[model samples]
Target: MTIPHFISIGHITHDLVGNGITPGGPALYSTCAARNLGISVGMITSFSRPLLQPGLLQGIDIRCQESQKTTTFANLYNEHGERRQIIESVADRITSTLIPPEWRAVSIVNICPVANEYLPEIVRLFDKALIGICPQGWMRRWDSKGQVFRKKWENFKEVLPYADIVFFSEEDVSDPKKAVETYLPYTKMVIVTQGKLGASIYSHNGVHRSPAFPTIEVDPTGAGDVFATAFLIRYFETHDVPESARFANCVASFVVEKEGIYGIPGLDDVKRRLNVAR
Candidate 1:
């Protein structure tokens, strides 16, 4: 089999909100976003067999490690759009061994953990690829009661050096300024996404700001994952950080206009938005 161009490694989650249940996690959102960009994508994820809908991953090359229960989360939103997350259950961690031998050399590798299920050592497996990390899961810790809280990523120094770029949201860090200062030296690029304000890219060249495109916001569920995947794809193609951020912002603008994965924009959709922005 031909190797996929993009690979997303993480947990496939069951996200509960009010009366609705949806398939989530960065693995789902990132892979779908890559596919929307016309890239051949693959996934290395752990989930409960019965809980997953194969149709949701139809065209991708999937290596699913079955766990007794899928990692699950319940999100409660406040009037101001702040979120409180509760972990219902968790799946198995993804080790380097679970990664297909062929996929190790993919053009792009996205380490997108949702429950701290991905090991930091997995970064060494893809030495030749542009490794992009979305480390929200690693920065999180949950109590026995399953209330999730922000925690310092103990392995940041060990893993960030190997990553080409790191993506995280403002809400993911307790001290945004400190987090940026800590990780900026380890990676070539660091992006802190700020919802409607867009994203800021930190590099040796200084911070480059990308403004978010205006749209009717419906759901912000997977916008960060969408932005990260889109940014990496554009960065790989152009090697222009500012341009990539702008393109990614345009792509993610569509994702928030609808709920679930329904708003993941295709290449044409992004192109239309890009054209309008120009």
Candidate 2:
């Protein structure tokens, strides 16, 4: 089996925006960001559609468990730009048994559960790789009408101890600082993204604030996923937390200026923007 440098496991979603249905989810966005940064990437997901669409992460390895329905979300934005989501459909859960043996040794692993499709035990599947957890999906609950709402991550203790780093948006929790405080005891590092306001990083060393790069915001769909992906990739390479946060913020700035995967930038483009931001 060909081992990729990065691996993201979750359910790839079909998101409803305006009158169009687009492929989305953290796993897909992370793979696109990883590929643009010139890293060999692999994704494990459960989807009903063709896993690799035309012009989407063409060369990356994507493993799929054929499912009856793809995880779907209808995004409704208010006049103030806040988003309200409805779960239109859902795919199958990604079980540990679906993971390939060789892929366990990948350098960086991102367990991105976009719709609560992952079990907490799946975090233990990796050995020494840096495991980044994006738990928005785990923190969500929907009603009979499928309206999404934030709920406590009931089994966070079961998973956080095994993760090297945890990333989430301020909107994902009631209080971002308290959420970071809650996660720091179990994980080595915790990052709470505040969109245009920037991000905060908490680690053993101390808390560092990384400012966002100014850009015209087009769509905020996968900005957090791209930020987490860039941070993990850069941190894995250099082990510099402050530098990684700044680089991540710069990379994510580009993604929000465009729609969906088209916003994911190459390393050179990111470097240029990083230099300008400095």
Model 1 Cα lDDT, one tens digit per residue, 1-278: 78999999999888896798888888899999999889999999989953445566767898888789999999888877788999999998787777778888899999989999977889889999999999998989999999999998889988988999999999998788788899999999889999999999998789999999999888898999999999999899999998999999998999889877778988998998789778
Worst 10 residues of 1 by lDDT: 49-58
TM-score of 2: 0.97
lDDT of each: 0.89, 0.90
Root-mean-square deviation of candidate 1: 1.2
Per-residue error for 37 in candidate 1, Å, reads 1.1
Q: After superposition, how far is residue 11 of candidate 1 from its true place, in Å?
A: 0.4
Off by over 4 Å in 1: 50-54
